[model samples]
Target: MKIAFYGSSLLSSYWNGAATYYRGILRELAGRGHDIVFYEPDAFDRQQHRDIDPPEWARVVVYDATPEALLRVMDEAADADVVVKASGVGVFDDELIEGVMQRAKPHALRIFWDVDAAATLDEMRSAPAHPIRRALPDLDMVLTYGGGQPVVDAYRGFGARECIPIYNALDPTTHHPVEPDPRFACDLAFLGNRLPDREARVEEFFLKAAALSPEKSFLIGGNGWDSKAMPANVRHRGHVYTAEHNAFNCSPLAVLNVARDSMAHIGFSPATRVFEAAGAAACLITDAWEGIELFLKPDEEVLVARDGQDVAAHLAALTPGRARSIGQAALARVRAEHSYALRGEQVDQILRDRSASITHRQQQMERA
Candidate 1:
């Protein structure tokens, strides 16, 4: 299948949380002999922080956020077997949603891959006549990064023909344990861009923990934290590139996963960092989120922290041996069930099933 995907940056994870997820899924799909072209806007300084060049598995097309670029994308998308416009492109998203539907119709299979399903649903609820609502019924498939049953139901409520969850998974090949980097070395490390939805959680779960554990070294890797007053124990690295993720995870004594407000409430929404840190065998401490047990067993595979006090207690008491045990267990579980190879197969099957259904409908039409 020739698939054209328009999403956030794939080359640089600069401020894009979906980069690793895209790389993992696309790489696996390409391995299964599918032709993939990724379209990303030249915004967010992603070009300046380019982490890797276009991979042999897929072509990465960086386009300016302009009307001219939209025309070019529409032309390119018309020829694809599947054209997907993922949520949260950080630019011209509303326009892209309409453009993909208008141009890719009657030919390419149209899919709206919602990386942030909860937020999109919230938008739909608040504005029923939004462009996304207008586009929903026309989509051949509505796929989500996470939000399990709730997301599927919400999309279906908007008149989607089909809705599915493509949860974030581990790419062991790219994210296995690596030697720790001294530059990022710390007792606790949190990597995430400072988005409004998650800033409060970062303050409650990450920053406060740092303040409480004054003797422990804490590291933060992401952009948009220059203005915030961080605890003296917490060191901030402006932007961590995609290539350094494994080292960044391993460098810390333990890694933290802070769920954004919407995602935590929606349940089953595991951030990409959760899988990355676990894949690197970093003892993971995550802010409490529903359905966490579905991914990693709390207090076993991952430690669940409800507040700063919980995080501080974990930092104060967790032993090196215990941390290693939890890290290894989490790594083992992810490698077995959450690998990109598994997700790629699921996507392939969904497409095939949809094709069969379409064929059946055509045959029925012929009979009539």
Candidate 2:
């Protein structure tokens, strides 16, 4: 199958959180003999901070953030077996959604892949004329990186033909245990771009924890946090590139996963960092959210915190041996059950089933 995916940068994790998710799933899909073409707009200085070159597994077309460039990419994607318009492309998102519905060949599978389904669903509900709401009925399927049943049910309520949650998983080849580096060594580290919805949570869960545990070292790595107020024990490394993520994850005695307000409220949406941290055998302490047990075992594989106090308590209680044991357990679990290879196979089956169903329906119409 030839899959044309329109998404945020695949080559850059600068301000885009979905870059690793895209690389993991698409790379696995490509390994299964599918041709993948990724179309990302050159916007938000992402091109200037690319982490990887055009990968061998997928063809990446970086287009200008202009109407003409969008049209050109849309035309190029017309012949694909599957056409995906992902959420948060950061430019011309509505146009791309409409274009997938309007321009793709009738036989092509049209997918609205929502990397941030919780927020997207909220937008659709608030705005009746949202492009995804209008396009839902015509799209063959809606695939989400997270937001399990809540997202599926919400999309169905909006008249989607089908919806599925393809949760984030570890790509062992891309993210795994690496030797700890002194530059990133810390008691706890959190990596996420600064966004309005997530900033408050970051302060509460990360910064507050650091303040409470004054003796422990903490690190923050991501874009847009250079000016954020933090405790003297905390260090901020703005915009750590993807290449250094392994070191960043491995060096920290434990890593943190803070969900955006929408994702936490919606529940069941695991951030990509969770799997990345787990793959690197990093003990993870995550803010409390529903459905985490479905991915990693609580108290054994991961530590769940209800607030900053809980985070501080977890850090205080964690000894080096206990942390190492938890990290290893999480790593083993993800490797056995949540690898991208498993996810890619699930996606392949979904695509095949949907295509066959479409063919069967068409044959019935012909007979009628």
Error of 1 at 228 (Å): 1.1
User: Which run of 10 residues does model 1 get worst, by summed lDDT?
Assistant: 100-109
Candidate 2, 213-263: lDDT as tens digits: 999999999988998878999999988888898999999889999999999
Question: What tens digits encode model 1's per-residue C-alpha lDDT throughout 147-220?
Answer: 98988888898999889999999998889899989999999999998999999999999999999999999999
Global lDDT of model 1: 0.89
Q: Say which candidate scores most in TM-score.
A: 2
RMSD of every prediction: 1.3, 1.0
lDDT of residue 151 for candidate 2: 86
How far in Å is the alpha carbon of 284 misplaced in model 2?
Answer: 0.7
Q: Scored by CA lDDT, what does every candidate get? A: 0.89, 0.92
Shift of residue 176 alpha carbon in model 2, Å: 0.8
What TM-score does each of the candidates earn?
A: 0.97, 0.98
